[model samples]
Target: MIDYGSEIAITGDDPMMDFRADPDLIEFIEKLGRARNHYLSLTRGDFTLLYENEGMAVYTRSYKNETAFIALNNTSEKQEILIPTDKLGSKKQLIGLVNNDLIKEQNGNYPLSINGEESEIYIVRDNHGLKMLNVIVIIAIPIVFLILYFYIWKRGKNNG
Candidate 1:
């Protein structure tokens, strides 16, 4: 219900509502809420079915050059599937934004095993988060120096 900006309404009628009394359930809900609210692409993104089979299906939601890869296992048993990624632009890794799972593309495909009926969402991107941080620092240094230089120049001009 999050995709396309649909409101997710939870009432007392849900089958899982019985767990409302459990702290574990509340914790899980909190985590899910964080996952849903923290990611803008998950709420408003272009949806595409990447792969599908009788036992499982894989899809993606993308926005602003970012994409979330979602996988669902429909059967009660563990199912393994290879998601072809040759067509997904330059994405080489899928880091779980909430699940803490890390997946790397292999031979232009991603192999995943889902346990029972479960769903996983991964942010499709290169494992360059740390690199990006370094890049940010690198880019900021010159800009900061330029700003300081201009400020000092202006102050010196006013004083003179």
Candidate 2:
């Protein structure tokens, strides 16, 4: 958890920004979500973020107004994240999920809002087709089994 008033000097595109957890907010941040990568975008500056493996990079566009942007990626296929509401600044906003399809659901508990919009957004990964298979199993497998059982039982009655 980042403290509400912690003064964090965000500069350049340091990898540390990926999980920019404030020391003062550590206790609070720990309770919310695991710090992955975090960074702030200044409207008038240029920066680059390089991943440890160099496979991922984040480029920023500086504007005259103060705009803060954060990108979170759950390299793992299954992950759960918590966002601490108290640590977020008033001006902090989520630019990506505002009106897009990535948003799965929203809750009122967390201050997970962007650009003055207060709402929680749930993000679901495609899971490389495995997730789809899982869903099919849950719904289709049972129906298929029941149909096969009925078909075999009816055929035996007719034969007898």
Candidate 3:
């Protein structure tokens, strides 16, 4: 067994004295910790390896009817990845979790581009939610009118 206490000073100045009080470094470290926790949580779910190439890896995680896509570019050059929507079980608009950017699907493929040594996390959401809401509203309008019409007719008959 090795003694860990001997490697660090017990009652002296800290070895990293300069960086200990830096606000930006502290904030960056905190953010990095949060990112790491999020990544771990994502990995614990139903994860599927979508693609892996020489310089890139892509995967998807799904939980509770929500799905996310993760892509890592291992090389120093920028890489563009085309993900098939069928692999995700449904075609939807992918939104970047970090930047809130929208990725549209075209020709049954969703394209994602990442920079060197960069990783991107995206949430998959159906873009048709609003359209479905509109359809519900359109269908409800006629039913609401019919109910009002019947109520007024009954009131008129009772009064007359």
Candidate 4:
């Protein structure tokens, strides 16, 4: 079967149609479609190489308002890459778009791990803000209320 269009046509160039396609081909195509969808929405900008060592390369796609970090493990083995503080800007965490993995900043380094021949896109964000907010709400507010109550009680007793 051939698929035709007007300009910049595909011309049925997909060779997999000529032979016995693998049973998993459908699922694989679905996965590829999902990745393509994500790329269209999240990765539309100038790409900058962030880190490269041995068999892995990390990059960030920037478009004024949005930025996405992508790490690729080209080799057939697992890779662990340590991203330094300079490349991280002020972001403290990487939230995965595909695998939903969360990589946190530890001691100024972001630890990245990827499986053999895999890639991941991440959204950078800060983890410290919520922590400080928790401390203020759970710890600081109660302490201030307790001090005020104690002062009023002491003043009332003295007057009585």
**Candidate 4 on 73-156: residue-level lDDT in tens?**
999999988888788765568888767889888777888999999888787766665676787789988899999999999999
Q: After superposition, how far is residue 105 of candidate 1 from its true place, in Å?
A: 1.3
Name the candidate that leads on TM-score: 1
Q: What is the overall TM-score of model 4 with all chains considered together?
A: 0.58
Model 1 stretches with alpha carbons more than 4 Å out: 1-20, 129-160
Model 2: CA > 4 A from native = 1-65, 90-93, 97-160
Model 4: how far is 37 from its true place, Å? 4.6
Index of the highest-lDDT prediction: 1
Residue 147 lDDT (model 3)? 100
Tell me the tens digit of each residue's lDDT in model 3 across 91-124: 5888776545678888888888888887777778
Each candidate structure's TM-score, on Cα atoms with residue i matched to residue i, is 0.64, 0.22, 0.58, 0.58
Error (Å) of candidate 2 at residue 66 is 2.4
Q: Give the range where candidate 2 is weakest over 10 consecutive residues by summed lDDT.
A: 50-59
Which residue pairs in candidate 4 collide?
none
Clashes of each: 0, 12, 0, 0
Q: How close is each model in CA RMSD to the real structure?
A: 8.4, 16.4, 10.3, 10.9
Worst 10 residues of 3 by lDDT: 1-10
By lDDT, highest first, what's the ranking?
1, 4, 3, 2
Instruction: Write out the backbone clash pairs for model 1.
Output: none
Q: Evaluate residue 92 in candidate 3 and report its C-alpha lDDT on the 0 to 100 scale.
A: 85
